[model samples]
Target chain A: MQKDSFRVRAADLLDIPADIKGGLLHIEITGKREVFIENHKGILELSENEVTLNAGKETVRVLGQRLRVLAMNNNEIRLSGIIESVGFVREGSSCSQL
Target chain B: MQSAVNFVRGSVLLEVKSSYPERFFNLCARHGIEFWDMTNDGLGVFRIRMTVKNFKRIRPVARKAMCRVHIVKRCGLPFFLNRFRKRAALISGCAVFCIIAWIFTSFVWVIDIDGYAELDTARLLNELSKQGLRVGTYAPSVEMENLKNNILIDMPELSYISVNINGSHAHVTARKRTLPPEILPSELPCDIISDKDGIIHDITVKSGTPEVVRGETVTRGQILASGYVTGRAGTTITTHADAEIRARVWRKKSARMPKKYSEKVYTGREKDLYTILLFDNRIKLYINSGISYTKCDKIIKRTDLRLFGRYRLPISLERATCREYEISKASVSDETAYDSLSKGLMSSLELPEDAEVINADFITSSDEVFAYATLTAESIEPIGTKREILRNG
Candidate 1:
């Protein structure tokens, strides 16, 4: 209830409050893949069949895809297997173009 | 909770009272502690639990509220051990007294065998001696549990054996094993007959053969029974209706207060105690401390016994009793007299509901200070019919 220090991270699904001041983000690897990070910032959500990300704008979705968000500072996301791919997008990536 | 149990634990509990419960709760919250049993007894007596740990912290608060902060007067072994001023002389005196008392108590001064039915005194004592429970034996050395077990083992006949020590004596009470006294040793050739005037409910022949079957009509003494009837075989006899019956019987007793039976009441106080040596009245262990008030009556019983049957010494047991005082002359109307009579009758005769009180007699003259009544009750019991058969028959 107190706005004092709270953090939440999730795998397989990302249900973030869209109106949280800094907005929300999610990244994925195409092989049900693995994402390694040197450092990270926001959250990276991983799941089978799809990769979705929210970076202050629209959600990025890539199905039959493997992807990784690079240098996101202190936070990490990973998914590994099938099609084995990776990617990152800024504000306004289309969910319909997966 | 009672803290005055005189237990070995050093912990003392207090039942403190405080009006401002909120303040009390805040105090406990401020300090890492809690108060249980939060109850308000009228104005001031608020019952709350407190440990010895926080007594110092709350003492000032208790004083401020004039709260009766009772650390529930702990008479614990530690408190008693710590309470009194440390004096070497007193301690030594107590030690010496304890040693003397220890010695005194160590020696079994009196012994009584209670609850004896068939067990002989000599047999019990002999059995008790085997269990290290004889008179003049060291009380401190006597392991009561071990002694009980040992006695039980030695006399397997005793149902229960308890050894209790009060003051300087050991009370050895045991229940003697009782079975139906040697049952008429093998039933003689006897007969089954109606015990009551009513039709027999059922008949069972344990040893003898039966003659009366179920649903057989029979009268009292008109034996639907037989012992010497001719059987199917020429010389053989029919089922003998004989019974050397065993029955449980009890007797009811009735006694009227025939002549103002005496009643006793303890005045709650009695004196005249002297240190008597080994139950010997003549051999006083200590001189009687001078005091007044000797209108009381006391009953003293003495028993002498030896240690391991080596040397015997009598144990003096004095049951001091206050003398029963006689009533003074009272103004009485007819109603009060009748009430007194009824009370007296109720006390004397405890009758059953079916029992009819056929008579209530007042047997007192004008000169008599007390009045009494006699009650006659009617009851029923089966009278046994024993025919002393002539040997010729």
Candidate 2:
């Protein structure tokens, strides 16, 4: 935890993206239709209505209707189809809220 | 666009039935197996598309995930070609057709000649054939500059020539040499002579002395205007004679038509013969039985097969239509024969456009086998013609 905090502070002080320095997931959402996640760990759970992914420190859950994995590779996961909301569940946190 | 890439690379659609499908997805992602269009069917069944190479690598992933992967559909070029592997004849036919098409397109099929006026097309084509530029000649072997030069040297009448070969068609354009106009000696002493025996009605001499006055009778070859002109000092100077002499000319023309004539009467009976032309060889499609009609007309229509309405193919279809007819004797009425003969005689007269006809009389006569009409007419027309005066050196 100390090492992660020092890395975040260094990234902020040096004006660098934390995702690049701290290995954080970089998620980009486009108009509630598509969500592209870079620096992903793997898919945790997948279904038609929702998708959950392991993003190193947090579990990212995508809630949508007829959600699908458009494309997936080691570092990237692209989800499409009527995305409703995205909530992040940190370690030991309940799945109720972000 | 990605689908096109997948199709070219050969992809397979797989249906995964597993208790834990998310593990299968994560295993595929961890193994760097790119997949797309993933969907869930709600009964623990999911569908996804992956490349053929990745599908081969998915056996370990499927085993690790405890998933049974079934190929729902196989798509792309390899699968499509494998489906036709059993039909050997069809594949060979397609191969042969492509080979034949390639071979046919390598040679010239059509030769288009343009810009030819007064020059005979057949003669030009014959000349071109002699120089190895005719139809069916290999297009790449044609040396255009040498061919043009050879043809120009062989036929001096062609001033400019260009040969352009586009695919199986060769377009040859040529311009004919324009001959210079004839140069006449205007300084030569000449006389205006009467070309026909006529009574002089008017005479206008431009550069010579008038030899005949109005109402004077002149015969053919008689000089109407003399080339010798008396100058103001009474000195005789020879000059070219130019004059327009209008005179009353008499002409007679006669035409005869046979009273009995043979006319062609169609019997309404016809027969069709078909032929197939493959390149230069003609194959008769119809059986060769002797023609039944004694007198018939054979009309042949040839249709050339083409590709895309532009590329001419060597194969063609020919249909010969034979129409039977019989000859029947027919006689013309006296009045009809007289009218026909009179029209023929008038057309045969070959009167000038500006001539004015003063009087005309037609005499009709009939013989045992023929009817005749004679036309006698008097017209006022220009009768002067130039005749050069030959002087001894």
Candidate 3:
């Protein structure tokens, strides 16, 4: 047995987050086209930075220059970083200005 | 991974300066508070991780006058999180070790027979096999005590037995039991008899009646004289003699010298070399080549497995080899045949010193594998001494 050398990266108990349930998690970027994902699973697929999620009976697309979904669930979703705003792109609906 | 609590699991006493320390101590004891340093040292503090469930009860005790209730930063969540992984890891590690230990202990790969004497080794092994301590047996399944008892019972001459297992080796030690001495106990009075018939040289009587006289030629078992003395002219005669006569007897031995035996025999000259093996390859098996000459009977063989535990199963190797042999024996010459005849006669003939070789008449001679001949010698030797027993009414 050797000593563990993994440095503890402390975070505020409240700041640490979780989504205990299964769902699609995405990080999107408007200007950046390339995204890297080390691991993915389920009915999930991705290309570029945009993420299309059909979960909880909702087709949601969060468009931004850079975005990340830290965790997600059927009832609640956790997001991080600043966002410009949120809008939906439906089959019949188009992107509208706020 | 080990628990932090265990290293610090021993007690560190705590003494309190708070008013009514006795009450607090009692209350703590009542509430089963299991922490702290005991000696009083200016409002002693105890750091402990109490569950949220029990935290409420302690709140009232700490909230009393001159008491301040504060929950120090507890590191419980991560401790348990790490614990679940660590204990599982430890148990699984131990499980794997136990399996390997069991596997090594299960088989009796090497069997050792620790004791035996002039008893036949092969026969002992065959007997041991009947008792189930053979070479290729599994140790765990062997009932050693039962096996030992069975062996002792079956072979009464084996006094003690011990069976021990070390790793894959099963060792059996035994002691041979010796039988008691034999005695011929029946008392039947058969007349004393001489082993050989000879001319009477001397005689003495001890008991019973003597049946032969001095200067008489006595056949085998003929008593030479009487131990019972007859009283003459009012003299009382004793029925015993102090000593027996000594005699010298002639003994002879004769054997025909063989030119050669009909059966073929192996020559003492032999050679053998072995191959070395490691794993499956022959690295260096033997340190030296034994001998070079092979006679009529030759044997050549190689076996890698049985003697080496890892390479081969428990069976030895044997192989017959080809040999170059002489086609025929040269016919013995007359002079050579006579010399061989004398050599053979001298070796085989045994006679008393007084005995003489009146003549060595060679009957016949033949030379094939060897010259064969026979000899006849005559000799003189002394014989006949008797100790006779006499019966008195």
Candidate 4:
């Protein structure tokens, strides 16, 4: 945790984007229909209603209806459907509600 | 769309039946296997599309994930061509058609000639054929400069000639040579002579002494003006004679017409003969026997076959139509015969445009089968014609 905080402070001092400097996850959502996740580890869970992916430091879960994996490659995953909400699950903790 | 790119590179749609579908998906992603349009059916079955090459490399990943992958569909050019592998005739036909198209476009099929006046086109075509530039000749083999020079040498009447080959057509543009105007030497001494028997009605001399006056009768070959001029100090100076002499002349013409004439009456009988022409070879579609009708008119028409309404083919169809008629004798009234004879005599009397006719009279006579008429007319016309004066040393 201390190392991560020092890296974040260095990024702030240098005016660099935290996602690129710290190798953090970058998520882009378009309306309520699509979501693009970059810097992802892999898919943890996939279903018609929800999809959970492993980011570097946390787990990202997307809740939606008729959810599908539109495309997936090494570093990015694209999910598409009528998105309802998004939440995060920290290590050794249950899901944090959105 | 990515689908279009995948279709060109050959793609496969596979259905994966796995108890752990998420592990299969994550394995595919972790190994850098590109896939799209992935869907889950809640029955441990998932469908996804990927390129054929990438699909071939996903076997190990699928085995590690304990999934059964079955290709549901295959789409692309290789699979499409495999369907026609057993039909040899279609493949050969396509190859033959392509070869024929290439051969046809390499040679000249049509020859178009333009700007030719007072020169026969068939004769020029014959000359061009002799010079190795005819239809069906290979276009690339023709040496344009040499062909132009040889043609100009063979036919000097052509002032300018150009040969342009565009695709399967050869365009030949030519211009006929124009003869220069005749130059007359005005410094030489000349005299004006009377060309017909007449009485001089008017005389105007510009540069010489007048030999004949008004109301004077003159015969053919008589000089109407002299080229000798009396200059100062009694010196006789020679000059070119210029004059306009008008005279009164008489003309007579006669014509004859028959009271009974033979006219043709068609009986509505015709025969058509066809012949097929391939290049210079003529193939007669009918047997060669002389025409049955002795007194018949033949109308021949030639139609050239063309491709796509533009490229002219070497083959043509010729149709000859023979129409038959019969001759019948007919009689006319004496007044009608006389009028016809008079019209013929008037047309036969060719006069100059400036000649003014003063009086005309016709005499008519008829026998049993023939009628004759005589016409006499009087007119005033110019009578001067130039004659170069011959001087002896």
Candidate 4 per-residue lDDT over residues B91-152, each given as its tens digit: 99999999998898889988999998689999899989989999789999988999999999
Give the DockQ-based CAPRI class for model 4. medium
**Ten consecutive residues with minimal summed lDDT in candidate 4 chain B?**
B2-11
Give residue B7's lDDT in candidate 4 (0 to 100). 65
Task: Give the root-mean-square deviation of each candidate in angstroms.
Answer: 21.1, 5.4, 25.2, 6.8
- Please write out the lDDT profile of model 2 over residues B125-149, one tens digit for every residue: 9999999987689999999999999
* lDDT scores of the candidates, listed in order: 0.48, 0.89, 0.48, 0.88
DockQ of each: 0.02, 0.71, 0.01, 0.65
Interface RMSD of candidate 2?
Answer: 0.9
Write candidate 4's Cα lDDT for A40-79 as tens digits: 8998888899899999678999999999988999889999
**Positional deviation of A39 in candidate 2, in angstroms?**
3.3
Clashing pairs in 4: none
In the order shown, the chain A TM-scores of the predictions are: 0.30, 0.82, 0.36, 0.83
lDDT of 1 at B123: 86
Instruction: Specify the highest-DockQ model's number.
Output: 2
Q: B29 in model 3: Cα distance from truth in Å? A: 29
lDDT score, candidate 1, position B109: 69
Q: Write the per-residue lDDT of candidate 1 for residues B1-393, one digit (tens) a residue.
A: 344431544444555555543344334434544343344343434454444455557765555545556666553466667755677788889889988866775677667777775777788878777877666677777888887887778777888988886645667788877666543223233344554333233455543445555544444564434344455675744333444322222222333222334444445565545444444345544465443544446555444445567444464434333343443334554445555655655566544344334334444333244433433332232222332222355
